[model samples]
Target: MNLSLEITGLTKSYADSGFMLDNVSLAIPSGTIMGFVGENGAGKTTTIKSILNTVQIDSGTIRLLGKEMTDRDTALREDIGVVLDSANFSAILTPGKLAKVMRGIYRQWDQELYVRLTDKFALPMNRKIKEFSRGMTMKLAIAAAMSHHPKLLILDEATSGLDPITREEILEVFLEFVEDEHHAILMSSHITSDLEKIADYITFIHQGKIILTAMKDELIYDYGVARCTSDQFRRIAEGDRLAYRVKEHQTDVLVKDRRGFGQQYSGIMVDQVSIDEILLLLVKGEN
Candidate 1:
């Protein structure tokens, strides 16, 4: 399989805050979306900054487009479109002027595509970016990112505040972009429901460390939460449970297989787990 982005032992730290990206690593394969899951301070943005080489790293390797990535590799960046939590475009430039600037920067910039995207998103061509609402700014940013037809997209909180209809429209564009086997995406989002819709893989990060990485279907379909009394919990094998939390009268355990656990422990109730439940279990529960 062709990998669009690959990281190995990627580590970084800040002196004053003492937050470190400890041994961070993951891979994004071509034609697939990797949903980066984490809490606000779980090193999601830090990891992304490291990938962009905007922050200096203490250790590890990062490869983009099958080649080693460095801050100096300006050429490689043209192939990757990024939308951070907020739009970073100039305040004074209108979408029309911004398109002109983009035309100067990207050798392969498509004017027709830019116009189409802008029109589709209902962005005003003459309106200054500073005058736009948060959602409008976000839509303009995304439109700009895709105008040049980048092969990889790195979006952090890209879909956060958009309305359902707009989000659904943008999501369709994303799905269409990856129809070619050479495209891929690494989207960092708090919206698990959005990830559930489009992401092929899910990587969970907590406190600067990667805790879990699995196929979306496996995490959703195969994994489960086993709820039982403390007495029954003792009967569960050590290997059977991934993590567990104790409630007042019962214990909730995270098990890898819903059907298998139900069959093994006949009376214990094993229910299907969602991404949010999985995050709660892995972060709050203990083995």
Candidate 2:
């Protein structure tokens, strides 16, 4: 498979907070949306910053579009579109002026596409960015990101403030972006429901460590959340167990192979799991 981004042993540490990205690694394939998820302060933003070369790492290598990322690689940087939690554009500039500024920055900036997207998103061109709502600012960031005709997109909390309908519309645009085999996206959001709807692969991090990386369907369907009594939990083999939590009446066990476990223990109940449920169980449950 052709990879759009690859990180190996990507590690970073903060002096005061003691937060560390401990040996993080993942691969994002072309034409796929990779949902980067974790709780706050779990290194999701740190990882993205490292990938963009904004944060210096202690040790590791990052490869984007088959080339190692370097601070001076303007060409490589241009191929990647990045949208952060908050855009840093001057509050006084209108979207129309921002477009002109962006045109000078990106070699491949498409003015026509920018106008179309702005219209599609229903953003006011004449209003200053500070006057725009949270949703409008986010939409404008997305419009700028897409207008660059980038091969890769990196979005951090891009969907957090938008209403469900707007989020759905933006997600459809993401789907269209990756319709071509050469395009890819790495998106990090607390909104797991949105990720569930659009992401092809899900990579989950917890406390600065990667816990799981798997296909969305496999994580959702093949993995099982088994509710069993303490006695029944003891019967589950160690190799099949991923994580488990004790509830008031029973134990919730996350099993690697739901089908195999179901077939092995005919009477046991193996329930389907959502991305959010799985994340909760992994982050809060016992191994």
Candidate 3:
């Protein structure tokens, strides 16, 4: 399978914070939307910085579109569109003026596409970026990112600061972008619901480590939460337990093969797990 982005042992650290990214590794396949998820300060931003060459890593390798990433890979960068949490444009420049600046920077910048997206997102073209609301700023950033016709899009909290309706509109545009089969996205967001809606695969990180990387369907359908009494929980095989938490009189165990466990333990209640629940269980539960 063709990979849009690949990272192996991508390690980075600072003197004060210790390890920010510890042996981090993941892959984004072509035409796939990979949800990069984690709690705050879980190294998601660090990993992204490593991939973008914004931060020098202490160790490991990063490959973008099959080529090893380098500090001076401007050619490779042109094919990758990025939208970080904050807008990175001059506050005085309007969207119209920013488009002209982008046209000079990106060889493949599409002015028409930029205009359409700005209009679709209801971003005002007449006002300076400083005067725009947080949502409008984010929309402008996304519009600029898409106008470049990038093969791979990297979005860090791109849907943040938007109303539900606007978020849905942006999500639709993202879904349409990946329909071309040549495009891929690596979106990092705190919004699990957004990821659940459109991500093909989910890679969850915690405390500078990857907890899980699996298909969205497999995560939702194959894995489950088995609620059982403490006695019943003790009877379960150690290998079948992914994570567990003790309640008042019961224990909720996360199992990888829910159906198999269900067949084996008919008395235990195997409940469907949502991405949010899975994340909570994994982060808070014990193995």
Clashes of each: 0, 0, 0
Residues 22-63, model 2: lDDT tens digits: 999999999999999999999999999999999889998999
Write the number of the candidate with greater lDDT, choosing between 2 and 3: 2
Ten residues in sequence with the least summed lDDT for candidate 2:
82-91
TM-score of every candidate: 0.97, 0.98, 0.97
lDDT of 1: 0.91
lDDT of 3 at 4: 93
Better of 1 and 2 by lDDT: 2
**Residue 116 miss distance in model 3 (angstroms):** 1.0
Tens digits of lDDT, candidate 1, 83-139:
899777999999999999999998768889989988988999999999998888888
TM-score of 1: 0.97
Off by over 4 Å in 3: none
Per-residue CA lDDT of candidate 3, range 1-287, in tens?
99999999988998796767889999999999999988888888888888898988999988899998786788888899999998779999999899989999999899999999999988888899999988889889999999999999999999987888878988998999999788999999989889999999999899999999999999888999999998899899989999999989899999998999999988999998988888888888998
Residue range with the least summed lDDT across 10 consecutive positions in model 1: 67-76
- Enumerate residue pairs that collide in model 3: none
**What's the distance in Å from true for residue 127, model 1?**
1.0
> At residue 76, what lDDT does model 2 achieve?
91
